[model samples]
Target: MDCYKKSNIEDLKAKNSYKIDLLDYSLFITFFPQLIAGPIVHHKEMMPQFHSLLNKEKALINWEFMAKGLFIFSIGLFKKVFIADSFAAWANAGFTLAQNGGTLNIFEAWVTSLSYTFQLYFDFSGYCDMAIGLALFFGIVLPINFNSPYKALNIADFWRRWHITLGRFLKDYLYIPLGGNRVSKIINLRNLFIVAFLSGVWHGAGWGFVIWGSLHAIAMVSHRIYSFLAIGKSFLNSKIYKIFAWLLTFNFLNIAWVFFRSENLSGAINILKAMFGITWVELPYKFKASWLFREIGGNDKMVGFILISFIICLCFRNSIQMLDNFKPNIKNSIIIMLFLYIALIMIGVTPYTEFIYFNF
Candidate 1:
């Protein structure tokens, strides 16, 4: 509370504002739309809007903004209901198999990891979009939380794009306060480890989470070291190098996610063993005959869905980008409504599941 007050006062001072009543401050802090799992808004970004006459008028009646908000909300609903939930079953099954001391084949390992990847992305990003849309209905603009993080070329770039507000908070509060990059190389490395370790622990209380965070810290430190080397500098501008870097980063993140999703270190290791083909090359006949492998024609649908989702994630403009040129028209309205209808149907048919980050 003191920190928020201090920051708010500093922001107001910078803007040459003298007074903010308790009511306004209370409303700003307790805004329902982003109260949980925030795309953390600062006072400077929000407080002035409350004082603006235009926003005051829009709050009463704004048909265009309403339509836009509905469209965005529908998209988020579709992502959560249709996309994220679809993967949850498969993800759970695979993780369960690993937890039971069953060794997964390469195919099963990849499917499980990739399923959770897409599931987590769509689930969290979907919720963020819904929060943003709800806030927009009241003429409040929240910051964009998720970009195309899967398309990021490096770990640092990934952090910049994924859970952007959390990243910003950590950098501003934790990293900088710990003497970020202002000291010797050894000190900077220590700072990076501390931040990553805390970030891991923040997600959950488990050795798996700790290891996941440590893996990322090591990757980040290695990337930094590589950036300073002559060989890394020489390839900095190469297209092929950029492609390789992206692939490496993407795969590393996927691998690290095993730890994040697993119940323990053993489960994570089991998945990793299968992932790298250290377990077995061929599936057992009985296992192949089981419903798990035979269902849906042996994971073709899963692979196809994953491929399509990856393509869409890689090629499509993110929600924020789409909003940049947004103008609601009759055609777009119909499209959005159709999607909303389908999403509603899916929600009715599928069992209710909590958003993944709600656990965090």
Candidate 2:
């Protein structure tokens, strides 16, 4: 339920401190439901909805949308509780160990990296799902965020599918305006690099992020060349090429995750070095299974849970597509009820954080 507002600050600058109209902006930012994490809302999306709410002279009160919203919210809750947070606890421990260095094992680093990757995805995407669901509950549709990004065959495709709103903002507000692909080849490459570097900074104010962005830019450019040479002029509709593309894309993204997950360039370097058999050492402390379950509420018994949730999340093209295939009778009813029960169980647990994207 992310919402954005156009600031009136431009007009008020002359007055230095003009009285502000808090209604629309407040509604946009502090709309109780989406006040936490967001779809990274834009000014273009919020104003119209705010005006519509005001014109109708009512707050949200539609039951059908509300029910669907509740269901989606519940599903998001399960993803956060049953999946993301659980992974986060373990991943955080692994990341903490990685940060300490000198006592990190290669196996540990790999596990932690993979765990963090899962935690990052589910944590962020679960929040986005909740946001989208909440928005729809109010009869507004927020942009979709995750679309099996793990399956993407290139950085460009991954960007198109993952964190789509942020990608849109970067492209619209940053990339295109910075002479995107319209100049000489050298300038175009420079612009792409500049846009990517800025995008990394936008993700975080650190050198690690900068490197992450740079790596992505390089990967994207390489993929563009590959696409032009391989897919663009090819008459072969071969499955082998498709598989190769997917393999290349996934590996590139996985490699970049080192920088994205690292606390700093040194940490990323150490991890990369470890990947190349630099060294391995035991941690001063051992990880605990009990702590893991206790922290996330002692329900890791079912491996099927994670696999099923991921399958459901990944297999569907979009929510509309999911709903289209959904049976409205006993099957759908059962699924909805099961989701509701799981959501309630999760709610009974300890506190939870909002999606990871709020920082952006």
lDDT scores in order? 0.80, 0.64
Query: In angstroms, how far off is 224's CA in candidate 1?
Result: 1.4
Please provide, for model 2 over 156-199, each residue's C-alpha lDDT reduced to its tens digit, 9 standing for 90 to 100. Answer: 88888887777878888887888887877667777777776777
lDDT of 1 at 48: 70
Per-model TM-score, in order, reads 0.88, 0.78
What TM-score, to 2 decimals, does candidate 1 have? 0.88
Highest-lDDT candidate: 1
In model 2, pairs of residues that clash are 1-131
Off by over 4 Å in 1: 1-21, 53-59, 231-234, 284-298
* TM-score: model 2 vs. ground truth: 0.78
Number of clashing pairs per prediction, in order: 0, 1
Which candidate wins on TM-score? 1
